[model samples]
Target chain A: MFDMEPEVLERFTWYMREQSALTIMFHTKVAEQMGLSATDEKCLDLAMRADGPLTAGRIAELSGLSTGAVTGVIDRLERAGFVRRVRDPHDRRKVLVEVTAGDLAKFAHLFEKAQQSLVQVLSRFDPDEIEVIERYLQLQIETFRKAVINT
Target chain B: MFDMEPEVLERFTWYMREQSALTIMFHTKVAEQMGLSATDEKCLDLAMRADGPLTAGRIAELSGLSTGAVTGVIDRLERAGFVRRVRDPHDRRKVLVEVTAGDLAKFAHLFEKAQQSLVQVLSRFDPDEIEVIERYLQLQIETFRKAVINT
Candidate 1:
């Protein structure tokens, strides 16, 4: 690691905290608009972010909810038409949760707005600066994900 | 605004989405550690991030919860000692939610760990790179906040 100034660290910390707060608020708003409870929406997000459909047990582990609670969440999500549970193709005995493409299409506009904001922000920097910013983002995401998982 | 390559935009979009998901998971873990529901913890976070104490009405607006629901959140936060309801000093008739310093001290270690993660990430860049990264973060936060508020 390189040497860092204390004030630099302090300012970066403030940025991280502010971003966290904003992210939480944005999710709350998105959940509200989707007509799903925040918990249920968050669960669906977990499934959507995964590379493949996730088992209920895996979701419970990732979300820090009890297995029983996750079951109820999955049930509610299915009832809301936001997600569906299906038997895993490779593992016949396993059940997996998947986000419904048809239902999610309704919210494409909301997601598009978010993407536009990112584009607007990135447009401020030149290609080289964007590369540096991208490097920082990759490192920040990797480091923070490890920290969150270990927490 | 400047022209941007499509792939660059796509990569940055993925970073934003990943970061958002991680932030939500981090908040969920922190809330679980504090023994509060995610919604209640989120409301408390809004109060903590504000420049001053927030009235129940403001919390309701910011959190996208009804005033009645915000009342319940404040009650739970108060009972759990994460926050307290106090009469506004300037307007004794108006009640405000205040994050209790003494209670928050218990989570100092957790916040400190997050700060350390930021430091680890920042240390990878030299001062000039750090400045650029900081600029990116500042703009990203401001633009994203506006988008969240409007949404």
Candidate 2:
């Protein structure tokens, strides 16, 4: 039953593959421009978006990175003066990560510019089309989240 | 003009960002499983999808990677036993990249399984909805492609 419409399935697969590649290319380019690895950039993004400094474990969870991986990413960001690691005053065993103000000022323009570029590209589609894509993506992410939990 | 529903715009941006991260996670997982770097895995994918062995320049162009970057990717793949660098017989100046049989066999199963996983996730949406999402993605890619070209 699942074997229906081989050609359509193939096209869908190719489309997904190409879209994925294009995304990687854009990310790599932006990361290079910022002198950061893609992972490090993502960690900084997660930190900046948080309401306040977040614990390492929370950052790892938010970024969908492992704790050990987040540690390395934080280390790199710290070395680059983009982030700082602070010991949680109340809980000595916990450490909080925060993006540096200097880094925020440096990256803010570029980040906004990137979003503007993306918006311009997406402007080709009508509002309804954009809404459909956004909803579809949300559904896709939820499905993956469920898969991860079940596994 | 840019302030058209700020909340909706923010949601759209987050959707793109999350989709981008999801793609990187998917590629990174597959590459790690294959004992290859993400870039090398991408080169192998391009070679497999191409009709014949591709020149470094062509691979770089098709992959949206710089020629020098593609060279480095091919070099790593060559070292990892997944791909071989072949000099064009007729045009000695051109180096053609080809995937190894062992690598192809390994990638074939992984690729199919990944596609099945994606299809499973996408299947929740009706066919019309899937088509709408696909069309939006195609338009997005085309817009980005033109941006790259114009820039």
Candidate 1 lDDT by residue in tens digits, A46-146: 89889988999999988888999999999999998988999988888778998888989888887777888888888898888998999999999999999
The residue pairs in collision within model 2 are none
Predictions' DockQ, in order: 0.77, 0.38
Regions more than 4 Å wrong, model 2 = A1-4, A49-76, A109-114, A117-130, A146-151, B1-4, B49-52, B57-81, B100-102, B148-151
Tens-place lDDT per residue, model 2, A1-151, is 1333667677778877877777777777677778998778777777866789989999888667799998898898899998889999899999988778876677566556556667775666667766777777787767654543333
The C-alpha local distance difference test score for the whole of candidate 2 amounts to: 0.74
lDDT of 1 by residue, B78-98 (tens): 998888889988888778888
Top-scoring candidate (TM-score): 1
For model 2, the docking class works out as: acceptable
TM per candidate, chain B: 0.92, 0.72
Q: Highest DockQ among the candidates is held by which one?
A: 1
lDDT for position A63 in model 2: 64
Give me the overall lDDT of model 1. Answer: 0.87
Question: Model 2 reaches what TM-score against the true structure?
Answer: 0.77
Instruction: TM-score each candidate.
Output: 0.92, 0.77
